[model samples]
Target: MTTIYLVRHGQTYFNRYNRMQGWSDSPLTENGVKDAKRVGEVFKNIKFAYAASSDANRARNTAQIILDYNLANPPKLVEIPNFRECFYGYFEGMNSPETWLLTAHQAGYRTFNDLVTNFDLDYAKDLMHQADPFHEAETADQYWQRLDKAFEFLAKQVSFTSSDPVLLVTHGTTIRSIVGRYSSEKQFDLTDPPRNGSITTIEMNQNRQIKVKDYNKLKI
Candidate 1:
């Protein structure tokens, strides 16, 4: 089995402002830095065979901070552009949650989550497809295709042994995408959101079937 530890990057200025940050960039907040450090402290004793993050600075910096606290020799950090957050197009720097709610309403959804439970629409798949009356966004299909290829590549780097876990630092939506698309967890809700520096662990068999061992658990 291959053990994968997925971590969302620390909070950012955009996050503090409740803005949408897809493909856009922001610096980490004071609390975000502290959260990253705390994550490092939590896993200081565990060694990873591989560490990766999206090409975005937030994810790269978080991975670096965690590695600084790791007791073992850190592996080289790999930057995968495909692992970056979903591109929200015109909504990139807006209030992400608010935009979702408003746009969902425009799309005849009570809320983005309403699309899931009521309309049978997957937000991840349909966000870019909806008529936002603002700007075009990345369709859920495109996002999934990107993630599928990226994770497939990363999984190849993971050793089948359980001895060393792989660390992946990425954005919130990206993390949720990974869990939603690959893991066996059916109740995974992107609306609930993941806390900064939280960890989610997934175990993958040789066939690439993944079982979620943890979901957004913040031990710190």
Candidate 2:
């Protein structure tokens, strides 16, 4: 079986400012550095045969930091754009609260919380894909197709017989999509998002059987 550990990038300045940060770039906050370090510590003992990250700097840097602390010889990092966060289009870099107000209004929601209550947190993502007035954001199918191809590429590079697991550092939405689509656990919910720097473990067999061993585990 091939084991893969998926990690969400640490918090960023945009995350702290409540901004819509898809495709837009931002540096990690001080707390974000600490969070990545903590994740590194937690996985320090595990040797990774393969490692990768989204082309985005936040995810790439987080992956580098974790590998820095890895006791085992870390493999060369593969940076790929296929694992990038969903593009927010016109909403990129906008204050999330204000953006939500506009989105909620367009969706006939009285308030942002109402939208969340009605459609769950994914309402924002739904709006980005389905209701954006500009219609520039990627559709759900597009996003899934991108990730599907990315995973297929990664799986081809991974050997099922390897003892060391593979590691992938990516954004929240990307990680969430994978978990929601592949995890078999009954208790895992798509609406319950993973915290920054959280680790999710998945295993795939030669027969193409995929199993999520752990989902969104924040601590060791």
Candidate 3:
């Protein structure tokens, strides 16, 4: 079995402004630094056998802050491209509300919440991809194709059978996608977004069944 501690990266400047930040890099806000520090404190005593994050600087920077506070010897952070946030194509960096409204209207939904709650992350991605004028946004298949390989990749890079917990810091949407798709809990809604710097625990059994033990938690 493999235990994975998934942490959403700290809040970014784009997040502060309520912008569509998928695949668009943004520096961490002031509070974001504090958020990382708090997570570091929460995990100070735990020794992580492996540490990784999406290639985005926000995730890397947050991982560094948490590692900085670790007293336990932790492995160096690894950057994984598959762990990146869903690419929004032309909607990147645009106002979050505006883009959501546009997509929602096109999808025959009254609101973003309604659209997401009724459908799923994959549906959201497909809608956004279709809405993109240049068709640059990641389709549902394209998005999952990369992310579905993530666990296998990490299991190979880290010791899947090891007893130690693995740290994986990534963006909010990426975390949401994983939980919405693989979480054993059937009641979990796709519209429910994870908080920045939150800890979510997921386990993969020998049969590769993914179960989410916790979601959007402030502490482990």
Alpha-carbon TM-score of each model against the true structure:
0.90, 0.87, 0.95
Segments of candidate 3 deviating more than 4 angstroms = none
* Backbone clashes, candidate 2: 0
lDDT of each: 0.80, 0.81, 0.86
lDDT of 2 by residue, 1-220 (tens): 8888899999999998888887887998889888889999998988898999999999999999999989888888999789999888888898877877777777787555676457644555667656566888777777778877787778888888888889899988777767756765444766566788999888877665677778889864
lDDT ranking, high to low: 3, 2, 1
Per-residue lDDT tens digits of candidate 1, residues 1-220?
8788889999999999989897899999999999899999988988888999999999999999999999998888999889998888877798766776766775566565776555433463465456545546778778778887887888777778657888889988777766666654456765567788999888876666777777798862
The candidate, 1 or 3, that scores higher on TM-score is 3
Model 1 scores a TM of 0.90
Against the true structure, whose lDDT is highest?
A: 3
Off by over 4 Å in 1: 119-121, 132-135, 183-186
- Distance (Å) between predicted and true CA of 131, model 3? 0.9
Question: For candidate 3, lDDT tens digit of each residue in 1-220?
Answer: 6788999999999999999998899999999998899999999999898999999999999999999999999789999988999999999999988888888778788556877777877788888888889899999999888887876687677666678888899988888888887875455665668888998889876555788878898988
Ranking by TM-score: 3, 1, 2
